[model samples]
Target: EAGVAQSPRYKIIEKRQSVAFWCNPISGHATLYWYQQILGQGPKLLIQFQNNGVVDDSQLPKDRFSAERLKGVDSTLKIQPAKLEDSAVYLCASSSVIGGEQFFGPGTRLTVL
Candidate 1:
């Protein structure tokens, strides 16, 4: 089975700038998630989607970050007016079902200047 896919393995942006990242989950998976991982901290769940519907987004910074999983397959995450604190790894993951182990993609590492 093919693994998850992500683009532009790294990104550099200035504070207040805007950026977006893309993700392609495993075929036939039903749950997808976006997580932010800082330099030393564990991955923090940002948003979750069960198919094209949002399941959880409590930790997503609505003021700056937004995401969507159209057609319940590929997804995109965007951040407008980025901040220095946003410098971190944006990881995309997917699972075959709820409560299942997730397969991760090589994240897009963002460096805010």
Candidate 2:
């Protein structure tokens, strides 16, 4: 089966700017997640969606980051007024269900200047 797809692979932006990233999860999967991985740290869950409903988003910086899975397939994450601390690898992952092993995309690495 085809794996997850992400775009741009990398991004460079100034602090307090705005940026967005896209993700396409595996077909037939029901759970999707977004994670932020800073250098030397493990991926931290930012948000989760089960179909079109949000399952978890406690870790997301709501003041700057927002995401949506419109059709329960593809999704997008946006950060407005991005800060220097926001520079990190944004990973998109998907699983068949809760507690299942997640498959990750290559991720979009952001650099804040």
Candidate 3:
């Protein structure tokens, strides 16, 4: 099966700017997730979706970040008024079932100057 797909492998922006990342999960996968990996740290789950319905987003920074999986296939994550601290790799992953094995995308590296 094909792995998850993400876009704009790399991005550079200044503080206070806005940026967006796109993700396409594997076909037939019912669970999707977004994670942020800061330098020198493990990936942190930002949000999770179960077929277009949000399952969890307690870790997401809602004040500056937003995400959605409208059709259960594709997802988009956006950060407005970006901060230098937001510089990190955004990863997208999907699983066939909840709590099942997941496949991750290449990730989008965002640099906030």
Give the residue spans of candidate 3 off by over 4 A.
none
lDDT of 3 at 103: 94
Model 3 quality (TM-score): 0.98
Query: Compared with the true structure, what per-residue lDDT tens digits does model 3 show for residues 8-113?
Result: 8999999999999999999999999999999999999999999999999999999999999888899999999899999999999999999999899999999999
The predictions' CA RMSDs to the true structure, in order, are 0.6, 0.7, 0.6
lDDT of 2 by residue, 1-113 (tens): 99989987999999988999999999988999999999999999999999989999999999899999998989999999999999899999999888888999999999999
RMSD of 3: 0.6
How many Å off is the CA of 6 in candidate 2?
A: 0.9
Q: After superposition, how far is residue 27 of candidate 2 from its true place, in Å?
A: 0.6
Model 1 lDDT tens row, 50-106: 999999999999999999998999999999999999999999999999999999999
C-alpha lDDT values of all predictions: 0.97, 0.94, 0.97
